[model samples]
Target: MSGDHSTYAPRSGFTKWIDTRLPLPRLMHDSFVSYPVPRNLNYAYTFGGILSIMLGLQMLTGIVLAMHYVASTDQAFTSVEFIMRDVNYGWLLRYLHANGASFFFLAVYLHIARGLYYGSYKAPRELLWILGVVILFLMMGTAFMGYVLPWGQMSFWGATVITGFFSAFPAVGDWIQRLLIGGFAVGQPTLNRFYSLHYLLPFMIAGVVILHIWALHVTGQTNPTGVDIRKKTDTIPFTPYATIKDALGMSVFFLVFAYFVFYMPNYLGHADNYIEANSLKTPAEIVPEWYFLPFYAMLRAITFNLGPINSKLGGVLTMFASILVLFVVPWLDTSKVRSAVYRPVYKVCFWLFIVDCLLLGWCGSQPPQGAIVLTAQLGTLYYFGFFLIIMPLLGLVEKPRRLPNSITEAVLSRRQTSAGRPAGATAAPEDRG
Candidate 1:
């Protein structure tokens, strides 16, 4: 599939000259126009395109907002208010930038979920999956910094709380914390540092995104069937086929984004954030954004020390390990089978894992007391166990359903079954599940 890029041809003399000089048009034609993707790819595959669009939208809005934004701690909150009330369409830009971050995370979570469901992290794509995790880490850092730019109550406290986590490390912890905040605490220097990094990280993300896409095109996309393409019939040209689906998916996604932007701009934001930062008077409970909730829950889950490890350090390690675990996921699952579709046992476990994540998110938002703390501990256990225990064990003990020989057969056999024909009749007995 990676070798199939010879179909592009310049139509005119001027175009031909440019093609010989740079060949960027040829590269685009090969990558997007004629690239062959699985014929049976569902809407789940569209999130990649949606993410690209969201990234572009975020950068554009951010650049505009930065023009009016004040990085100073004293004027940061006032500058945001100025953008919302005084500048032309500044409110729209702010809403788009703010809400766009949420939707961007939503799309990325779904994209990662889809990857897990379809085994997009399997062998020959391990680097692709690792690069994706790298992108997620970069996004998290970018979002955390961006969250501080508002310089609201939550923004100030959130930065202080999160950055303080680094102090859990032995000897070097305090230094790391100081380096992150640019001083002893979350004050003027911290605000300046975060604002500059927040502005710069998105472009860094864009660069990594290029490498991610390059890796993806090199390995090709995984389909729902978990079967590789073996014939021309297994795939279709990307232009009209995949492009139309991506466009439709993005259209629906944009409508939801627009709704949040226009009608419920503050729905996803904290009311306390509307108030300016007050170091003297702290909010009752400082919560990070919703996207950070699950990890926050994990961070809080470690209430007790394990031998020499203190609670603070344990929680910090656990929180960091949760994300780091994903970097090794391509090697964690022992199964040769890609898709959960065939692995009924893993399929059940997968949904349970997702529930555990949502449970953790809920736990993070609430006061960490009584049942919530206990539940979060249990959820965190299951979260790691799903990767550390279940994934490795299930692959050896469970029996997966029969898989079709190739993508073409899977598509044809599904259609045949929907038409009331016996599944076994469409394929040889050995290939029938």
Candidate 2:
């Protein structure tokens, strides 16, 4: 959506008047239809569009769920049950909203991974990347608060446990905890506060999403080659080419999302949540949703103090830092080469980092004792190390493969190789550089 040149032409008198006064239709045509994108972009780019759709779906379903939801602790659980049992297609709506959050996070994670692989955070797109990370933080907060709306066993204690992390601060910790739960404990106030915020934060996320899109359009999109768009030949209009690919990708993604919604609605949720909240009886073990597992593992990983800081504070800092670090990734990485495909060592470490995150997620789900604790600790180390150490050091030392002269060259070379032809078999065009 970066190209500002508009080719929109209103055909009718009323349309021409509207175009002159408002230009709304012209804006759409220019932004979505006529905008230019890299020809080399792949399916990974579709996650952005998918995320937009999921956000709207969540807002729509959440509004309906909220209309019938009771914020009171006594009725919150029952209200959810009522929706599922008596309301018109409430079960479908509930399942869709629940499953939609999981799918939303899934798409975002893949989107972030693609960015890391192709170095979308580098250079002119740094603000675009930062805005994305901000959206992610908003999503996490929104999801966590929304998770607590049901007032189920997990919802109640999950709120209690997660909010309690704020109390790890040395001086203001207790105050922050009180502020979050609206009191010393997770009770009526906590539910009301979380409910109100859960309702409002999605719209806030939407605002940031608008800014995110603006930033994306401003910087344009990055491709797999990490090369800047240099000529018209290296790009295509957004209407038919990128739109078709995005549609196919979204179709496949929605198919999987539908399967989860229809058949295994509760597959991703915990059984303990089906039971109503009982403060008197705590579950044997507390585990958050899958998306939070890796960070949860990191939070529990710190079992020892670092001099003045105790283990509890240390863990809290580490967990928050894990997310905050992402904001500064633009500077943390020292690589001149944008894409991991060009850097052998970075490519290997990138995959290993993914494995480490999965391992941490597994560790987070298990009881943190014996080997799980140790594994979580190691995973935590690597999680930070990948960003703090490897990213900075490897970029300086690693030798990357030679990049093609331009995006067009890379695309043509790949096509030729795949067709049993040698690289550079295609006719060479004038290099923009």
Runs in model 1 deviating more than 4 A are 1-3, 421-433
Query: Model 1 over residues 51-84: C-alpha lDDT tens digits?
Result: 9999999999999999999999889999999999
* Clash-forming residue pairs, model 1: none
Per-candidate TM vs. native? 0.96, 0.96
Give the per-residue lDDT of model 2 (tens digit) for 1-433.
4235688989999999998899889888887988888999999999999999999999999999999999999999999999999999999999999999999999999999999999999998888899899899999999999998888899989988999999999889999999888887899999898888889989999999998988887788999999899988889999999899999999999999999999999999988999999999999999999999999999999999999999999999999999999999999999999999899999999999999999999999999899999999999999999999999999999999999889999999988778855433553555322
Give, for candidate 1, the lowest lDDT window spanning 10 residues.
Answer: 1-10
Clashes of 1: 0
**C-alpha lDDT values of all predictions:** 0.93, 0.93
Residue 433, candidate 2: how far off, in angstroms?
Answer: 40
